[model samples]
Target: MQASHTLAELEAVLGEQVKKLRLSRNVDQTLLAERAGISRRALQNLEAGTGSSVASLLSVVRALGREDWLSLLAPATTINPLTMVRARRERQRATSVRAKSPTAK
Candidate 1:
């Protein structure tokens, strides 16, 4: 089963990621916020680990030219292995029934 976390916690994690990326890139938050067209206060909220919209983060990310990381940060998808195994078995059975006679080899 999958577990869930609060928006606040998720935001905190994202904020930390942003702070690390920004510092690693040697850019200050003010310049980043200005380029993103957001108030410095909003940027501060992000850095301070307050819950904010993904759009807000994306705006800052684009402003910082770090938009490439979005794909990397997508939520992980869970798989039901039992259901998949059943489906695979069903498909194999169907395939066996639908199989054509072997052509002259």
Candidate 2:
């Protein structure tokens, strides 16, 4: 999705949506926070979209039974057939990083 607005706007929108979801589920902030294994303040911060840790967000999502939302952020991996074939052909037991630039050689 295009971000035409600021991150704060997005956070607010998310917070509102979460609030609606919680209401629909007939859950209170205290109960939700307890289920999420976080402090009430943290839950409040999340719902406000002010700023919170990824772990806190995840906990809240889980508590709300919205694990599907996580998939929206990070979908399952899929490999391109051509790239997979190339990788198989050039497979190595191990790889290491070079300390210096190739030009130094």
Candidate 3:
């Protein structure tokens, strides 16, 4: 389905994927947590979609030999010439306005 989901739903989906990946690799939760340098409870919480820190998530993904996933989370930013021009013009307008505003003595 191409339907959009809530943030909680997205987290739940990610948690399930992590759990499945761990199982497919024959890794137990305790072992995975130890390898990720996190507590077993943290892993559990992550799998349950309750809560998790970004560091913890990265650790777990790395422990699973999936560091490449980080790229998917944050793609490289590229400059847009049009946007840059628009921002520059906007800044110039703002500077002119401040210069013309009467100062309070």
User: Highest TM-score: which candidate?
Assistant: 2
What are the clashing pairs of model 3? none
What TM-score do all the candidates reach, one by one? Answer: 0.60, 0.76, 0.70
lDDT of 1 at 42: 90
RMSD per candidate (Å) reads: 9.6, 10.0, 8.6
Quality of model 1 by C-alpha lDDT: 0.79
lDDT of 1 by residue, 32-77 (tens): 8888888888998997787666678889989878777786768567
Q: Kindly state the number of residue pairs that clash in model 1.
A: 0
lDDT of 3 by residue, 1-105 (tens): 135887778778888989999999999999999999999999998988888888889999999999888998699899999989887733433333454447665
Q: Candidate 2: deviation at residue 20, Å? A: 1.1
Error in Å for residue 39 of model 1: 0.6
For all candidates in order, the CA lDDT equals 0.79, 0.88, 0.88
Candidate 2 residue pairs in clash (backbone atoms < 3 Å): none
Q: Which window of 10 residues has the lowest lDDT sum in candidate 1?
A: 89-98
Error of 2 at 57 (Å): 0.7
Which residues of candidate 1, in runs, are more than 4 Å off?
1-4, 73-105
